[model samples]
Target: MGNRQSVVREAARFAEWVLREVGRELRVARLIAGMTQGQVAGVLGTSISHVSRVEHGLIKGAGLVALSRHAAVVGLKPWIKLYPIVGRPLDRAQLALFAKFRDRIAGTWRVTLEAPMPIPGDLRAADALLAMPGCQCMVEIITRLADFQAQVRMAHRKQRDIGASRLILVVAGNDTNRRAVRDAGAAVRDAFPLDTRATLAALTSGVDPGADGLVLL
Candidate 1:
């Protein structure tokens, strides 16, 4: 319970930090495009104050529609880069593993790496989206498990957008990762069963895994 709350709180803080940085970047983009707040407002069909609020991060939970339109006019594309929850140092190692994992099964599955789903508020970049004959699967790579609850929440959210028949949480093969999975308890298992063999077999055989599961690499 304490772990769950801590995970949720950290996820919320990370989200807030991303929003602040987005606001700052948007302001910089506006400047770079040589557009004032008023100009952006005019293009967005809103008041200059509204544009100012957005630029200043005063607007809460800004949707993708507004963001896309504003960026299109200002010659800036709104994008979010996904980094391991553990931190940037894990980026190269984690991403490489994710790619290799995808490549290993690519002979059988049609895999899309770093697939983007523009879901407002729950925007996520799927590390791998695997498609076989009948099933579409969302594969997420976790080098280190920072937050199980947050990971579950995100997988649930992304499932709708990815339209996956199943979800697989792929974790790096390490002591820390294995311990985190062990500590995740029954609820996490209920959501994502730790069954790498079943997942791999399903991918290889082009059949559905029948439920959410784990893939250890």
Candidate 2:
């Protein structure tokens, strides 16, 4: 009985912390980009209330379609994807692969994470990501990689500087699951000059304690 009480208390504390952290990130990003709440809300096709809920972590559940849209307004490159775990144990390959770009995305970056498998009830992947050392704007991109590709392509076609400032994708996968990602990088590079020199070789299996994949800018 005592343990149960502790667990409940811990869960409540975690929820509160997540809400406060997300609020801080949203506020900071909105300010940094010199964009207003109304403007951000417009981009999201939502009212101030919905955006407020998201920033406050009041959101409880999301579908693939909804997540894709929300991530877009948050101004991160959004994808819809499911992935089985890949890479070496501890599954830090992707982080290592993306290491060279870490510093840029660490603080200002926003992210959308997805789990291919049925996620545990207790694990809020999005919030956990926000808690990562340098993660900011972390949201979950739910569905298939193809969906995510389409989202990015649309953002690229519709927006002036799509994905230039965001660390768009973060799923649990490895080299096998990264082909589409590589192609997307190529497509983005073709359209504009980004820091494309970094390659997968530079990364090692490690965690990016601090990073954000999706962003306002």
Candidate 3:
């Protein structure tokens, strides 16, 4: 029993170490990003003091979710840059794919195509988006597609830039996809086309849009 207690105490200490290190890294990342605590706090729904405390190794129970949100605000989002291998840089094709998305993606809503979804080909399929009753959705789709370079362009597609949104990138030929993620103003979630709602829900419960897009298909 004493030994078990000792192990438990050690585990707790390790966890705390991880949080502190993350907080330290978070502070460094924020500085490099040229973002203020207040700015980051606004995005995370927390106060400047809270961000300061977290950065100073003062947060008591900073969970993974909070850490992720803070990391994103500080621009330390995972896959922001791809290191297929340690100490390795991305190749040209890989760089172009990433740049395509980075340059093309803008506005408040961002859509990434990773996995394919089952949607109808007829106009009826877009009825939901068409029925939005305003130009907000149109602006989002335009901002989304125009942000990237694609062989296939759509005249009309449905999407939105509301927060708490995610999508999969249907990467085909060429390898510039990695750059799309690194240069994003916001987080560009690198996704496999196979990731599904069930899988996403397991990670974090949020809205994920479909990836099968076409202006006229």
Number of the predicted model whose lDDT against the real structure is largest: 1
Candidate 1 global lDDT: 0.75
Stretches of candidate 3 exceeding 4 Å from the true structure: 78-217
Cα displacement (Å) at residue 37, model 1: 24
The sequence of per-residue lDDT tens digits that candidate 1 reaches over residues 83-195 is 33322133687788777676556477777777776644443577778888888888877887889888778777777776888888888888888788788878766887647
Model 1 residue runs over 4 Å out of place are 1-90, 103-106, 118-123
Task: Give the Å shift of residue 97 in candidate 3.
Answer: 51
Task: Give one digit per residue, the lDDT tens place, for model 2 in 1-217.
Answer: 8866876776676556655555556656666777777888898777888777766767755344664565455554443333222111222544443342344343433333332123332231221122233322222332234654555554333222121222333343445335555666655454323222231111112234222232111
Model 3, position 96: C-alpha lDDT score: 51
Q: How far is candidate 1 from the true structure (C-alpha RMSD, Å)?
A: 12.0
- Per-residue lDDT of candidate 3, residues 27-124 (tens digit): 99999999999999999999999999999877868776787888988878632221111112334543455455334333333323221113321111
Candidate 2 ranges with C-alpha deviation above 4 Å: 56-71, 76-217
